[model samples]
Target chain A: MNSLIRFIQRVSTTLLFLVLLFLSLWLYISTSYYQKAQFGRLALGLSGRLAERVSGIGQYIRMREANIGLRQENVALKNELEFLRSYITLSDDKTMRYSRLTLFDTLNYSYIMARVVNNTVNHQQNYITLNVGRCDGVEQGMGVVGHDGVVGVVLAASARYSVAISLLNTDFKVSARHRPTSTFGSLWWPGRSYTHVRLAEIPLHVALAVGDTVVTSGHSAIFPRDVPIGSIVGYEIAEGNAYSIDVRLFADFRSLDYVYVVRSADRSERLELEHNFSPNAND
Target chain B: MIKQLLRYLGLAVLLFALQLLVFNNINFHGYVAPYIYPMLLLVLPLSLKHWHLLIIGFACGLLMDVFMHTLGLHATAMLIVAYLRPFVTPSDTSRAYAPGMRMGFRWFLKYALLGILVHHTVLFILEAFTFNNLSITLLRIVLSTIASTLFILILEAMRVNGSER
Candidate 1:
């Protein structure tokens, strides 16, 4: 009995270390999903207050550049609005009927403007933080896009702030299509260049030219039809008999300052339909 | 014993504060950022049992993860490094690790780099949660390890130099 006690005393430190390590590892595994979610909510709410304080300082340095971009965007939007007005006038009867059907009916999607407080383009799973949050009606699974292109989907949100898993993250994927041919593929980051991504599962026979514009497929209702994704830079036939094409992303993730969170109007209806189709499956 | 615990507490807080306020904010064109807080675990008194070392490491990492909103990533990396620390701490038993003692720079570099490398490898892999782009992952791990090791060396050297003067 004394011998066993002596042995126990001798190895107690090692056993304790093992216990601590195992406990921490379990904590890590369990928390990787749930705690990241819960902590992200609490952290985005409280710590994002501090993140805002820091980004408030950064906003000053970015003001001049932001002004230039906003001015350009303003000019582009004005041109688009003018073009729409002229087009509507030219097709007066049909446009009037369409507007009458939808007017005061329902918006297909609406955007909530939010300032990006912090953004990272370098990590394997990069994330972006926005100044607006649950208080502003931001919710998990909502799509976020920049002025020029798709950004990412919302991962978690709190009262005062929110975090989105950026397109640069390995965990993120977007369905994209070649503008000319409408051949759709999956867009993902290769985790190499911050300004680049890969479009996969595009069949090899499809005609793809360098600089061909790519846009969201609209297959999923997350992003609306015709949102610009990027342009193709190179292509090669790879495994699974699909073209693995490199894309030069249009949105400059490094300089992202403001973005829009899109709230889909009829997503609930679509989800309900899908749920009814397969009652046992998760939506 | 209480005094020793208090000192470690102060040091841990200082290290965590520096990491949160300074190092994390500094991104060098998306290539490198020195994670200096692991040095807190590295330099804690050698007299501490391995159990204390591991618990402190877990807490320190969890704290960092909480602030960053990356819950488990840092904790996993730190736990491994802390568990392996006593095994890889020193080569020359004469000087071993006095924490404040001036050890040979090369030996010190080798020791610190190993810890940083181990920490970074686990951290980045779990952060990506995939091995699809092994090259990019390797690049991140290597660059971060070098930057962090350099920071650790410089900090340790400064402390050692300060005490002598």
Candidate 2:
């Protein structure tokens, strides 16, 4: 008994290290899906607050560039609005125009403005922290977008802050359509350049051209349809009959300042119905 | 002893803040972001118990993980470096490991490079969680290690110069 006690005491440091190592590895592996752990939530809140305060300096310095981007986006939106108005007025049928306006009003998505507190593009698994959270109607699984295009999806939301899985993350994959052909495939980051992502499962038969745009397919309730993701830059044949195409992203993740959290009104309902149809459908 | 402890604590806080605020945002070609916080473990008092070293390593890494949203990646890597620190550190037990007048420049550079290499290897590999893209992973590890080593040496030089006065 004396010998056993001495042995245990002598190697106590190694034992403690093993225990801590196991705990950390478990946290890393398990939290890959969603960081729902209580400690994770608490840490996220604390970090978010700190990052928010520190990022203020950066935000102020980049205010002019962000303002210019916003102004350009405003002009583009105004042009789109003008085109829609002319199309409505040119329609000879009054009832058709009224129904078209009603269709626009009944769109299910709403946008909530949020300031990015912390963003990482170099990491294999990148995450962006935003200042808005549950208190501001941000929730898990909601899609986030910048002024230009798709950003990421909210993974977890504390009361006052939320963390998003950036499009640059290897773990993040979104259903996207090749705008020219209307063919759909999965878009994911290849852990390389921050400005580009790869689109897979695009069949070789689908005619693709350089500079072709890629947009969200809206197959899932997370994002609305037709949100611009990127434009195809290059492609080569992969294994089997598919083509691996590289896409240049529209949103500049390195300088992201403001973003919008997309709240889909019927997301829960659609997800619930899909879940009921198949237990593993959501996954 | 109490004053020394307070000084170390302050250093930790300063390094942590610099890592989170400045270094984290410097993504060079979207491949390398130097991690300078590991210097804390490299320069810690050599007399600290093994258990204390391990705990401090884990805590520092956990603090970084919390802010970076990489929950355990940093902690695991930092802990491994902490465990291996004694092996790379100078055999003499009387002094802390730092690039100073007493320590040879070559020896200190070797010590810092080895520590940063191990830390970056463990971190980038585990974060990748796969060997499918081995080339890119290796590029990241190599680039980040070089960048981190350069930063650590510069910081140590500044520290040594300040103390000489």
i-RMS values of the candidates, in order?
Answer: 2.8, 2.1
How does chain A of every candidate compare to the true chain A by TM-score? 0.88, 0.92
Shift of residue A40 alpha carbon in model 2, Å: 4.0
Candidate 1, residue B110: how far the Cα is off, in Å: 3.4
* lDDT of each residue in B1-165, candidate 1, tens digit only: 898678668777777766755576566556565688998888876676667777888878887877676776788789888888889665354654354325577777887888889999998887767787777778888998998888788778877776568
Give the alpha carbon lDDT tens digit for every residue of A42-77 in model 2: 677777898999999888799998999899989998
lDDT of 1 by residue, A145-246 (tens): 988899988878888788888898866789998899999899998777788999999987899899999999987768877789898899999998899999
Question: lDDT, candidate 2, residue A276?
Answer: 88
Candidate 2 stretches greater than 4 Å from native: A1-10, A36-39, A281-283, B95-102, B161-165
Recovery fraction of native interface contacts for candidate 1: 0.39
The alpha-carbon interface RMSD of model 2 comes to 2.1
Q: How accurate locally is residue B101 in candidate 1, as Cα lDDT from 0 to 100?
A: 29
CA lDDT, every prediction?
A: 0.79, 0.87
